[model samples]
Target: MFSTVYDVIVVGGGHAGAEAAAASANLGAKTLLITMNLQNIAQMSCNPAMGGIAKGQIVREIDALGGYSAIVTDKTAIQFKMLNKSKGPAMWSPRAQSDRMRFSETWRNMLEQTDNLDFYQEMVTGLLFEDDIIIGVKTALGIEIKSKTVIITAGTFLNGLIHIGNKTFGGGRAGESAATGITEDLVKKGFESGRMKTGTPPRVDSRSLDFSKMIEQPGDVNPEKFSYLKTTTALKEQRSCYMSYTSLDVHNLLREGFDRSPMFNGRIKSVGPRYCPSIEDKIDRFASKERHQIFVEPEGWNTIEIYVNGFSTSLPEDVQDKALRKVAGFENVKFLRYGYAIEYDYFPPTQLTKTLETKLITNLYFAGQINGTTGYEEAAAQGLIAGINAALKVQNKAPFVLKRNEAYIGVLIDDLIIKGTEEPYRMFTSRAEYRTLLRQDNADLRLTPMAYKLGLASKERMDRVVEKQEKTDLFVKFLKETSVKPEEINPILEANNSARISQSMKLFKIAARPQLNFNDIQKINSVASFITENNLDNEVIEQTEIHVKYAGYIEKEKNQADKLNRLENVPIPANFNYEKVKSLSIEARQKLTKIQPETISQASRISGVSPSDVSVLLVYMGR
Candidate 1:
């Protein structure tokens, strides 16, 4: 029997729930985490990987904000890669291939070690609400649990329906049962909900494959980690992944199952991820392409199971096996399980405020797939923000919100709340207009101080950030003050194909050339001695170099961000009635009224609201 009321109750135990529970408890709230299976905590349900492209930047941001995702990732990674190495620092992303089992176990251990947190294994059936305000949850056995605030991070589990070829079943995942009651109850309570579909590739026995026929994809020669914390261990030995291609023969073999494929036969009505489409969908969409790339990734260090990445399907088991055999290195492939598609219930994010709390219900918040978002990184970011805001609400403190220019987390939440997603939302670097200011290398610089003030990020983390900043500033100042003659600089510059300087110039100016780098400049005796005396780390030196190299672009982006922040400062009263404003367009009024945007800037971003509408609202606000 549940008697005492908790400060926060978090539902589901995937990436989002884990962070939510950790954040709420670490911030001094008594939190309870309820899940159907505790052993599957933070399970990498799809791929045994984290941090790709924009997702990588988000993980670092999470780490900087006192979230545990990046630390866990570093602890369990089997391979590390910094993607887009050829591109600028703003575009570089750190990714890792994790040992799936270790990833989950690490998360479980972390949750158990956290203070003010309790875990319960139960399927939350419904919410406990009083007059449109959520107070707690109800389990399947009808036991009532009370809480001041509740965060539902139920990922791909609510009313989940799985499809394998023509066969269908009620399940959240391959071996897990579907969760019910909550989605139905929420809909009855006037919350808008819809269905979304996502799928995973089949797992195959690694020994059955021919490695010689596939191309090897190795980890970075010099790898970097995700965590800003110093306690995490760096990877010493990394496993290699392989690349194979699906040929025309494989496509022809797959098309034979079109009649029974769940996707094509109309069994699945919901939309899947647009960017990471199923193989069958890919073949159909790009008929002109000769072959599709398949990434063969290992599941774990000890396990022989391999994930057939890029081969997601809902075709019959026989069709899946036969088609996989046609791939270059999978001539004798054996499947551990056939790939399947699952459709689950999600609420439109527009129904929620920027803090992730529902507009219709007080103390009720939604994160992860429940908010129509895809990817573990996206889910984790939402959970941290929601958890932080939930605790602040309980303390009667102002809600903590991040600006778009500050963190990718801000951009994600803003996009969801402002322009509600029709398809599952995934983050991309292109989404951030001021990406140069939002680079992965500088996530700690952007968010740690704010997080430290919130009591989520610790003093130690803040101190580390301060130390790094000070060292970087001194290094930059040194470069600007020190003059290097042509005799000292020409040898390095000429070797790097940079034009030789005619006279003595500041080292900062020469380092800014496209071909020259900090490492090359450090060859100067005085510069190397300065670095050694300061005991500066590679990251600090690198940060200083990037700042000087991209100074122009960085300042330009900052000015633009400042201009936008002006409109952001003009707050629109929460109780403002758009209908009373006679000059507003009908569509703008309707959208503005429905969204109830918190600021003039948010109102400007809404689809139907125009610049003229924003001007009218600004004038109405007496700006």
Candidate 2:
């Protein structure tokens, strides 16, 4: 029997639940985090790494919004690499290969150290609801703890069914038991749910692979970190990942098991991530290709366990071993664990508000795979938002929602609530219309202020953001004012085969040229002295160069975002009858009524609501 009523109760201690608890407790909420297995807190159940492509941006945004993901990742990272560095700053993303056990331990330590947070290990069997609102949760042991709000980050545990080859069993993961009752309870309480599938590649012993047969993929020479806080430092020592290719012979060997593959044998009824397909799916889909790449990634500095990236399969164990050994470097590959595909329950995210609170169940929120998202960063982002809003609700404060132009988190939640994914939702840079504005380098500049106001981000974070902004502004001003004479810049320009300027050019203009980057610009005496005089770090210089180079694109994207935001400002009445809008398409009306969008902008983004439909909604809003 609990003596105190918690302000927030988080179910399942994965990335999402962990973040939700931290955010709520940090915002002054009396929070309790309950998990079936405390030992698996923030488990990297899939890959032993964090941050990739747009997921990296989400991790940085989570850090800016006062979440523990990036901090923990930095502390446990064995290797660091900034992906897409050859591209523009907008494309640059930070990725780290973490020591698996260390990452989980770091997360647990961070949670335990957080004030106002308590931990409980129990399977939350069902939610305790009063009428249509959440009040608490019931454990499998029949303990009912009271809470003002509940966030379900159950991950892939609800009625989970795992498939390996022709074999199927009830399980959330390899050895983890499936969580029952909660999904059924939710459905009975008027929540709709669906199923989705995701899988992890086999883990092999590193000693079994031949490194000479694969290409070495080393970490970046100048590795960048995920967290914006100065407390975490970059990795000095790094581990190398090896890239090996699977030949046609390997594909043929895998093809021999297509008859037994759960994915191909019609055993998996749900959809999996289209981009991250299993090896069997890949071979079948791209039959013309002779080979596919597989990454041999080290799980930790001390462990010999290797993650076999891009070889996810639900084929027979014998077939998996046979196909794996055919790969260039995996000739003597020994499996630590065979790959598996799991089918789990997920609620249609469209049933939730932008705050991640279910529209049908007051104070009952959803995050992680329960909301149909598939990455740790995505789950953590949703958890941060849900936790902040849940705590703010208890405090009688207005809800916090980020605009799409501000962060990828915003785009992700917006996409889910409006469009609703039929398959597992994964983040990509292309998904963000204003990716240039939402660059990884500017996550703190975009989100830390709002987080600080909510008391989630610390004052130290706020101070750092302020300092970075001030210095970046001053540096940009200096670049604009200082002119580079032909004698001072032409030689450098000529060496790079760029058009030589006859007249004096502003330092900003010279820096903006396509062929010139910060490295190239640093060659100028004035630029070098200005950087040295200001004692500017690489971060500040990086920010300055991006601003100078992408000024036009950034401005254009901002203008477009502004246009959409205007529609966002147009409010729709909560009880507005869509049936009365005769001019609206039947599909639009149905979507509007079902989703009950709060803003014309949100309605515009709905799948069935078109430009014409948005026009009608705007007219109804007196726009």
Candidate 3:
């Protein structure tokens, strides 16, 4: 039924593929999004939520880059909270509980509204390759659609295996069929693939839960959102989650199913996510601990389904029910759905470049769980970057890539492409070295301009960014240029528990003190009042605060990053033979040859490579 050649073709319609298709189409590319089932587009298969820790930063960055994750999340969010508020700014993350149905619907609607995007419901069984470069995709019905660039984000559906206790079946998600043929074809075509596993918890009927026995988990008093755009509307009367604990009784019941558990019985061989372990694994690993926490989170505003957090398992259904009833507040819980583990085919991310394109196949990119990473935010970030690069390739323009210091997305992609993952990777604040400069508060400030230049960000977004920047610059300048009298500011400073100033000081200098804040200074300084009088938005205020509070650290980080970039800029020749370097260690040569790092800096960071090997490389490159 179709004969048009698309600029970009996106396989699978999960978070990654949806974002990729939207981005490419919005960038004026004729994009085609093909999936096994169109109704499952952007489904929250594992979790009914979005954003956490460093993943939240990625969502904001995607939003800043004109990707649709943030907007879609906001439109469908049922509950919102800013996590780690008591911690440092670098650790602060925004998380939201979404309406499962609404989230998928929002994505479908947005994709349909997009100008240059076309939708197709079909399984991509194979690829049409020309001289080692991907030229198009072959559908299950034997129709071939051509494209200049193809992004594969099949997620966990590619040869997916569902494990329930000792029984296994071919399925992507609960009730959804798995996609086959592509993995076997790719393997035959010389692509290296491996198996990875991930699991989800059961859904319980809310009516059967005993709320009086559980601890109430309320949302933040003043909630924030993931998107920088004004698309977020304040929720009316937010929902509250509850906390419960799994006791020894629960553990004993789960142990009864040990023999039948797929994880223990060797029925599932793929490595699951270490960070988010299954209930049985958690019990096994943490035997010393008396109890584990479980959260009862509502699936949506309208649904009666409650997600049983911290209870992910592949144990038998009878054992699952027996154990779940023993948990606090769930004595009468009814299992609306049983939990299970999913094993799927994933191409080790080491085979990908920073652009997410496979080294084995040109113009063939992979993202999401297919690349061995977990979480919707991580997938969407990859999808967006891959889409941008794919569109750029179609336009014959230079690829747009971000530095590690520039974004969390950059850090994530860099880690996957450089180090490669042995486990399902999840983003954390500690994973980033320059996290002080990668705060979520300023993600839009760091990325919007670049997106605008690439013609991905909208004009309205660019205008808002420009205005915010101008106002923040003015505020920062005012603080730097203005001087405050010691006598006038001392009382206000004392009220904030800050030391009294001995002499007059620049407003900027006083604001930079750890004990002082914009509000504290506003009480004594005129410039602070002027800033308030302008009625700037919260995002603008947040930027000014961060800029003033972290000036020293930011400056130091920038200098360090500049020095590192010098090494990054030192490009390595692709055809250079590491085996020729006789002075290099055997292990170093092997690693260098396998990774084929794009720069000397990347080569230096590989685990087995040594500094001496880098010296050999530098000497060989005549540096």
Candidate 4:
């Protein structure tokens, strides 16, 4: 019954798929989102939270690029936090605890309202291909849907197998059935694939827990939102999360199910996420630790269902209950559902190009768990990039690819294509070397302009970025040009434990002091009046302050990035013959041939390719 040739068809409706559909359609393409169940769109499969550490920066970047993630998060947030407030602005990250039901509902509502987008409920069984290029998808019911481009964001659903102790079932999620045919079809088409495992924590009944015994973790007194746009407001009457610990007794009780544990007993062969290991994995890895922390978080504004964070396990239900009961605040906890681990097929990301399009198939792209990444933020970022690039390819335009120095999304895609993660990949601040320039506060300044040049970001979003840039620039200039008299600044400096200046100094210079801040400096009459007259908000003032404070460091990073980008400009032909470069090591040759890096900078980043190999390639290219 599907006769129309859609511009783009996105398979799976998780965070990644949703963004892909929204992005492609927002770019004026006729797009269709096919999910196994429309009700579960944008489901929070693990935690009921968004944006933490590096992931938060990614959400902001997505929003700056006109993606809907940050807006949806802000609309549904029940609690808000700016994590790592004590650290530098580069470390600062915005996080939100979302109402799970509302998060899903918001996504569906936005998608329905979005123009040029359509929705369907169907399991994509196989891809329709002509030669090596993808043409469309075939559903389980044998309905063939035609599309010019396809983005597969099938998160943990390809031949997925769930395990809880000895019980095993074929399911994508806890209750959803596993998707078939696609993985086998792809493998037969000469694509390499492997297995990965990820687990979730049990959902406990909030009424059953004893919160009085646990420490309450409250949200920010003055909460902030994820969106740069004013679509969402700050949360009021936030719900507090509780922190509890798992004692030695709880560990010993959990260990009782070691013999039945699928992870330990070899039932699960794939590696799980190293950063977010399960409770049993933690106990096994960190035996010296007497207790592990557990966070008890509320599921939503209305529900009594609580998420037992930091207690993810795939142990038997009896053992899970027994161990959980021993925790200080969960003495009589009742499980809404037992946690389980699921193993699913994933293609090694090295097979994909920097634009996230498959080298083997034209107009076909992969994002999210299908590319072996974990976390909703990571998936969503990938989806946005993939969606943008896919639409660009369809329209016969230049492919959009972020660089390592520009954004975290850039580092993520570069890392995946170059390093090719052995286990499930998750974003960390350490992963981006130029993180100082990639702060959450300046995501719009970095990406929105680029996105505007493309058709993806709206004129309103572009105008906001322009205004913010103009305001920040003016504020910085004011700080640099305005001088503070010793009498105007000495009292503030003395209060902050800084030496009082004997003479007048520029406000920018005073702000550069380690102990001083913009808030204290703003108390000066001239500075305060200047801010008021310019209509500068906290965001603009903060941006100006950070720029003045970290100008030297930011310049140094930019210089380094520019130096490396010179190497990046040295293009390598797609069909370059690495075999002819006999001076290269055998391992380097094989890796270079397999990865087929687009630039010399990318070649240098590959694991086996050494500096000597790069030198040889440089010489060869020069010749």
Listed per model in order, the count of residue pairs whose N, CA or C atoms clash below 3 Å is 0, 0, 0, 0
> lDDT score, residue 198, model 3?
95
Please give the TM-score that candidate 2 achieves against the real structure.
Answer: 0.99
State TM-scores per candidate: 0.99, 0.99, 0.97, 0.99
Scored by Cα lDDT, where does model 4 land? 0.94
lDDT of each: 0.94, 0.92, 0.89, 0.94
* Residue pairs in collision within model 2: none
Model 1: what TM-score?
A: 0.99
Model 3 Cα lDDT, one tens digit per residue, 1-623: 67799999999999999999998898889999999899999999877889888888889899999999989888888788888977778888988888999999999999999999999999998898898888899988999999989999999999999988877899989998899888987888788889999999999999999999999998777778777778577666678889999988889899999999999988888899999999999999999878999988888888999999899999988899999999988888889899999999998888888888889889998989888999999999999999999999898898888888999999899889888887899989888888988988888889999999999998899988889999899888988999999889888888878889788899988988888766676676486577668877777777888899988888998898887798898899885688888898999888888888999988888889888888888888888
Deviation (Å) of 553 in candidate 2: 0.9
TM-score-better candidate, 3 vs 4: 4
Better of 2 and 3 by TM-score: 2
Model 1 clash pairs are none
Alpha-carbon runs more than 4 Å astray in model 1: none
Give the range of the ten consecutive residues with the poorest summed lDDT in model 3.
Answer: 519-528
Output the TM-score of candidate 3. 0.97
